[model samples]
Target: MTPEEFAATFERIRREVRTVIVGHETLIDHVLTAFIAGGHVLLEGVPGLGKTLLVKTLAQSLELSFSRIQFTPDLMPADIVGTNVVMQDAEGRRYFEFQRGPVFTQVLLADEVNRATPKTQSALLEAMQEHTVTAAGTSYALEEPFFVLATQNPIEMEGTYPLPEAQLDRFLFKVKAEFPTAADLVEIIDRTTVADQPQARVVASREVIRQMLRLAREVEVASHVKAYTARLVRATHPGDPRSADMARRYVRYGASPRGVQALILSAKVRALVAGRANVSLGDLKALALPSLRHRIILNFEGEAEGIDADAVIQNALDETPELEEART
Candidate 1:
């Protein structure tokens, strides 16, 4: 699809989602970007913040198979990826049948994912990264357009397990849902309490979404922009000579190569939405926070001081130049 067509399609889905969701233009945009960029998203917030609702509303606006998995301490790997069952045919021959789990769907909402154990959480790693699930000595290829939009509560909350770094790395964007303003809360109550409840309508089909994903990949990236992205990622490392002062003081581990992938793909989507055929340096910079927030691990000092990841990322962005070397 052309850039204009891509933007139009994206806006159509966004408008359809807004029919039910209240204010959260930024969060909504990030989620949609991850969706079309062919990456997973982790929605983190406290309860009653509509995180789950947003995922469902977005699913409603797409013509793709959607499934919901309510994660708990008891949830298992097989529960998510499914298990083999012994089945008998009419001929009396029994064989192991692979029954696909909710992970097989195009859009999967993993609600309360932090409540699940790390082992269970790890079940989604292969699927999120390789788009395939291995079981019973066989690998099942997930269909195209597969996405895992997981909702997670803050780890400080009761009975929650912090997602491992590996799990966090699987997500392309980590969006935090802020509490609504008083005015927005009132509007929310008004809409929900009335007889005519708001609903989102389907706006894009699976093929259209696939096309957008392909188009996003085709967006040109300048060498300077690529170099800038690498420089930004490296700057997050405390051990790197070019690291930012804040990062060296506050960060223990830097973002991985996957983080760079997240920034580039999401920036491409942003570029497409802005009707641009080439990615600008600003697109990567604008996307740095969400693309790298969960990827960076804080040092003991930073953790004790309760430093926010965004702060460290901001410092890195400040330290890193848009162009590595001037051609002029």
Candidate 2:
């Protein structure tokens, strides 16, 4: 698809989702960006902030099979990824049949994912990275365009387990769903209290979404823009002498290679959504917060002081705003 057609299609999908969602334009945009990039998203928020509703609406607006798993401490790996069951055939011969779980769907909403134990959570590690599930000594390839949009309560919240760093790394963007403003809450009440409720109509089919994905990958990125993206990521590392002051003082670890991938890929999506054919420095910078937030780890001192990862990433952005020659 051409850039204009790409932008038009993206806007149409977003508009359809907006029919039910009240605000959170950026949240919706980032979710859509990750979806097109064929990457999963991790949404962090407290309950009742519409995180679940947002995921549902997105699935509804697109032509994809949708399923939801309300994760809990008792939830098991087999529950999410499915388990084999004994079955009988015509001759009374018994065989194990794999009963597919909710994870098999095209769009999966893992509500309160962190509520589940890490063992249960690890079940998704293979599926998220490899797009396949191994069960009963057999490998099952998930349907194309599979995505896991997981929502987790804040780590400090009661009964919530922090997602292991490995799982966090798998998500393309860690979007924090903030509480709505009073005005937005009023609007939300108005929308939900009425007899008629809004619903999203499908705007794009799987083929169209796949085409958009190919187009996003085709968006051009100048060498300097790429180098600049790398610089921003490097500056988040405390050990790097060139890192931002806050990073050097507060950060324990830097973003991984996947962080770089998320930034570049999401930037391309942003560029296309903005009707641009080439990715610019601004595109990468605009995405740095969500793309890098969950990837950066804080040190003891930083944690004691309650340093926000967004603050650290923003500091890095300020320190290295452009590409420069490596210092000897």
Candidate 3:
């Protein structure tokens, strides 16, 4: 699809989703960006902030099979990835059969993902990264265009197992869902209090989404723009010469290469959504936070002082020059 066509299609899907979701335009855009970039999203927010509703609405707006998994401490790996079971055929012969779990669907909603133990959460690692599940020593390839949108409550820490860094890196974007403004709250109340609830209509088909993903990959990146993305990522590392002051002082670990990959991929999607043929430095700057926030680890002092990852990323953006000449 052409860039214009891609943008139009994305806007149509967003509009359809807006029928149900209130406020948070930026959040919706990031979610859609990750979706078209063929990446998963990790949404951090308190309960009743529409995180779950957003995922469900996105599924409704797309023509794909949807599955919802309520993650809890008692949840097991087999519950998400399915398991092998013995079954009897019509011929009366008993054989081992694989029972598919919720992860087999195209769109999976892992609600309160952090509430589940790390073992149970690790079940998604293989499926998210490899797009396949191994059960009983047999591999099952998931359907094409598989997307996982996981939500976790940030305020409730008790009994919650924080997602390991490996799992966090798997998500393309870590979007923080904020509470709605007063007016938005009024609008939300109006929508929910009435008998008629808005519903999102399917605006994009699975094939169209796949095409969008392919087209996003085709978005060009100039040499300098690509280098700037790399520099930004490198600056997050404390020992790197390009490291920003805040990153050097506050960060314990820098973002991994996966973080840089997500930055470029998500920026390409952003460019396409903006009807641009190529990614610009501005695109990289705008996306740096969500793409890198969860990837950057803070040190003890930074944590004690409650340093926000977004602040560190912003400082990196401020300090990192986009052009080579400006670097000097």
lDDT of 2 by residue, 1-328 (tens): 7889899999999999888998898899999999988899999888999998998988888878899999999999999989989999999999988999999989999999999999999999999999999997899999988889999998889998889999999999999898999999999999999999998898998888889999999989988888888888889999887899999999999999999999999999999999998998888888899899999999999999999999999899889958586442
Output the TM-score of candidate 2: 0.97
lDDT tens digits, residue span 1-328, model 3: 7788999999999998888999999999999999899999999988889988888889888978889999998999999999889899999999988899999999999999999999999999999999999998899999989999999888456777889999999999999999999999999999999998998888988889989999989888988987888888888989887799999899999999999899999999998888899999989888988999999999998899999999999999999887874243
Give each model a TM-score.
0.97, 0.97, 0.97
Clashing pairs in 2: none
* Candidate 3 or 1, higher lDDT: 1
lDDT per model vs. reference: 0.92, 0.91, 0.91
Residue-by-residue lDDT tens digits, candidate 1, 1-328: 7899999999999989888999888999999999889999999999898888888888778877789999999999999999999999999999999998989988899999999999999999999999999998899999888889989998889999999999999899999999999998998999999999998888888788889999999999998888898999999999998999989999999999999999999999999999999999999988999999999999999999999999999999999988676222
Residue 204 displacement in candidate 3 (angstroms):
1.4
- In model 3, the runs with Cα more than 4 Å from the true position are 325-328
Name the runs in model 2 displaced over 4 angstroms.
326-328
Predictions ranked by TM-score, top down?
Answer: 2, 3, 1
Given candidate 1, what's the lDDT at residue 22? 90
* Backbone Cα, N, C clashes tallied per candidate: 0, 0, 0
